[model samples]
Target: MSDQHLLLLSILTPFAGAIGIVLLRQRPNLREAVTLLSATLVCIIVVTIFMRFDNAGLMAVDIAEPLPGLKIRFEIESLGMLFALVASMLWLITSIYAIGYMRQHKEKNQTRFYAMFAIAIGSTLGIAFAGNLITLFLWYELLTISTYPLVAHAGNKKARHGARTYLGILLGTSIGLLLLAILITYNVAGTLDFQQGGILAGKLDPAWSGLLYALFIFGIGKAAVMPFHRWLPAAMVAPTPVSALLHAVAVVKAGVFTVLKVTIYIFGTDFITSSGANDWLIWFAGATILLASLIAMIQDNLKMRLAYSTISQLSYIVLGALLATNTSLLGAALHISMHAFAKITLFFAAGAILVAAHKTDISDMGGLGRAMPITFGAFLIGSLSIIGLPPFGGMWSKWYLGMGMVETGQWLLLSVLLASSLLNIAYLLPIPARAFFGKAPDGTTHHRIKEAPPSCLVAMTITSLACVLLFFYPDPFYELAMDIGGTK
Candidate 1:
């Protein structure tokens, strides 16, 4: 089949599954089976597309414009390929994890949850391959609306509150900042197409360029730069699988990816560097990284801590993007892949612990390592990856990011990267350390907290193993990421 046809199918398959899930809701097992099958198929298609991609060519499809100069489209590009790879691969891990988590926790609306998950992944693919600002904005909003149901799947007061925050911030930012940015770009440039080296270079007033930069950065709320990050932590009321989707799989990844795309394809790196527009951006990213890490240290809830970790990790991408150097830009792109595998693995293990032990606080995990050794060991590996330590996939991305810092010769940013890495260790490593090394306060001998369900174990292990594999063979992804912006 044509790659364009497959690209369109990648978006539609999940939606098709969602509809099928609703039709078969009376049969829970069948509904979930459909979810698993469709998710697997989507991943298969994504890989096929990647393998077949003419590394140097663009595969595009365009539908009619709904209005003048605006249309629906999807394309195969290096950056979008990396994104599709992450979203599709993680969907498999998450689906496996969900089978165990939803069943063990006995979550309500099982069919609805799986259905929404399908649709969300679909929209993520839409965003990944979107050919222009108009296509991206439509799919971006679609992703927001699609995942809202999953955020509130619990239907509790906490879930409702989280849903409101998520909806409010995302919609508010998109309408308020993102839409305005698009209007301004079209007004100034007469087109909304994203191009390498940027369409706006030398065209925009150097002073007003900063305003455009601000609009794009804030407008794309998914990047979750602080002030905009409350929505993320608040959304932690979601089920762990949904949290996995939020932090690792689709939602937040989409946000940062959009920012990276805009910075490279809309503004052009040299233009940003010359305009000094990125000077303020670097500080913004550094602030978010440091501040979010501090907040994570204070969060007792394991998932909330991870949510904050996500906020901080996301800034790594933002920092690389704003640095606007080739190495830094590559680091930003690589981080998107590395962070997805590492963070999703962490979330899977967290979900496993909650399912088996009914515990959520780090303090409550004393000696869980004895019973859930495999899960915790994997968690530890994922943690190491996040801290950018060796033998795992995350090291390469951070190495590149740090190199980017040095390339730019920003000592302050170098310090920021170093300090943030230490902070990552403080918050992430402690969870597994406490799980294994910590002693129970009451001195109760609780040895029965075994590994979570087989499905959860299976899922976490797959992602954790993938992390190590990535460290050894990140070339494929590296090639695609470098080629995406044509930065290399």
Candidate 2:
């Protein structure tokens, strides 16, 4: 197939799977088979595209021109390729994890859950390959709408409330702030196509750029830069697979991915640095990083704690983008993949706990690891990776980010990055630590508890191993990130 055909197919495959899922809803086995098939096809297609990609510049295909000079387009660039690869591959793994989770947990609306999950992956692929700001915005909104059903899958009061917050904040920010920013870009530049060095550099005055940049920053909302971040934690009432999707595979990744996209392609790193547009704004990312980490340290609910941890980890990318140095941009890009693997493994472990032992609060998890050794061991590897420790993927990203701070002499932000890692250790390490070493509550034995279903263990094992393998190899992703940072 032609690259353009493949590009279009990548987005359509998941939607096609969604249709098949709905049609086969009555046959649970058939419906799930469709889901897995679609996910596998997407992964294969994306890998093909990556294999054929030319890193010299972007390759684009215009799907439509909605208005004069405004087109819906798709493109493959280093960053987008990385994002697409991560989302597609993880979609397959998450599908495996979901089958185990939904079947064992006996979650309601299983067919609907599978269908919406497919659509959400489709929307995410659209966002990843978007060649212009308008195209990205369209897919961005579709992602929000498609995932709403999944977030509310439980159909309880808490689930409904979390879904509302998820929908409200995402829509409000995109319409109220993000759309405004796009309009301003179009008005100033006469086009919304993403360019390598930025179209806004000479056209928009540097003095007013900070105000416009703020619109893009807060407007994106999914980056979870505080005050706007409540939606993330609120959405934790969702099923664990959905939580994995939101944090690891799609939602939060899209937010930070767009932030990086705007930095490199929309704003241009040099333009941001020379104009000093992000000087004061960078602190918001810094604050979000520390404050979110601090809050994660306090949460007792396991999923809630991971949710807050996601909010903090996301800002690491935002901070990298705002810094605008090539190294910082590289770190931001690399983190997109590193964080995805590590965080998803953590959520998968959380789900495993819920399924096997019916535990939620950390206080109740003591000594449970003895019974469910594999699940807790996976969580330990994931936690160590998130803490940026050796023999894990996350270490590479944090190393580059810290190097970026040093290159720019941003000592304060460097301190923030270091401090956040400590907080990560404080909050994340303890879960696995307590599971293994701490006493079981009320001296209750957990011998009856067991590991999650085979499929769940399979998914977690793949991602957990990825954390270690990435540390040793960190290939294609490292190469792709360097391409964006212009360091290759």
Candidate 3:
């Protein structure tokens, strides 16, 4: 009943559910029931932690001390609480969406898909709640390993290839760059525990901090900074729900979240700003934002385009972190939630199209929206949010990010953000636009195509509505984000 126990339980619940899923594999309904139940419980647990975050005076839970002064610990903070809430809440939604998708698509090894999905969620929570570098590293790698099977779920050459790239880039970056950075950090600072103002401020030299910061930046490959970003698009051979997981719920979120975490808690914004450690690195984030948006415009496959979009969207957070301003940090943190709801809705719509219309390419989707209006409608809402347009959740985050640029007098980066929004409009809005207004390739009506299964529609509806609701009521995320900067 203690908060510490609940903290531990939050990580274990999904793993425990995975075991139950395997045990009930023969009974498809029971397996799915277990998945839903587990997801629900996680939501409840994380929400409880959120409510008590300000009131109950919860203590950090130390699971082990692997080495002297190096402990595997879990602690709840405003930022972690935000990420955990997003992952937990979306896990439940994604589970509902997956039930419809896998069943309707008749995906093989359904049990394995559900099981690996649970494990991945478990790993994500581990990363979110990690109090120290060691705990985070353990969970980060687990997330990569757990999601691989899902990426290769199709068991085809493409799936296997995508999964391999996914595994290779993530592991290579973490072990080669991220782990090295952690070691260097511990060597310099004598501790890996995340702190409010950062432990490396006085310890690491300003002259060398840029190099060390680069390690952390490129090391967290999931943030998809260019040249290191191929893994994300390659992994698009995965199922749509998995794509949703990768983009919104867990994988990419973890990457940007870690970037923010390291910036705020490891490097300290003041130190980075005063030291100019992120001066050159800020461009990488900016370039990824612009270039990835350009690449997204050229992709024909909906999910592939979305994948590239994700790469671009993620850099917004990375850029926010690198900017090292409180407003920028707040924007970056809010984007974590805003982008998640909008992007997941878009992916859900993509999956719905695949299921109902058997369409993948945008060129082939013309006029199909006439038949599957709800799916396309949801897609439109999602697209607008991603574009940072009015009456959408995504606008607020972009507003703050732009303000951050103004506050810092980074006019060039401000231009990049504006240009990226134009590119987002160019790439994202057209899918739904063409679906509704453009003509089909054969010039035939899509009278036979229908909406996706009920569950899929339900999931998409909820997320799309969230996209709108968050625009009006982003207070919870906004407040928590401000808390990260000690502004609350």
User: lDDT order of candidates, best first?
Assistant: 3, 2, 1
Candidate 3 stretches with Cα past 4 Å from truth are 55-58
lDDT of each: 0.88, 0.93, 0.93
lDDT of 1: 0.88
What count of clashes does model 3 give? 0
The weakest ten consecutive residues by lDDT in model 1 span: 440-449
Tell me which residue pairs clash in candidate 3.
Answer: none
Error of 2 at 483 (Å): 0.8
**lDDT tens digits, residues 301-401, model 3?**
99999999999999999999999899999999999999999999999999999999999999999999889999999999999999999999999999999
Tens-digit lDDT track of model 1 for 187-289 = 8888778787888887898888888998998888989998798888887888999888665659998999899888988888989999988878678889999
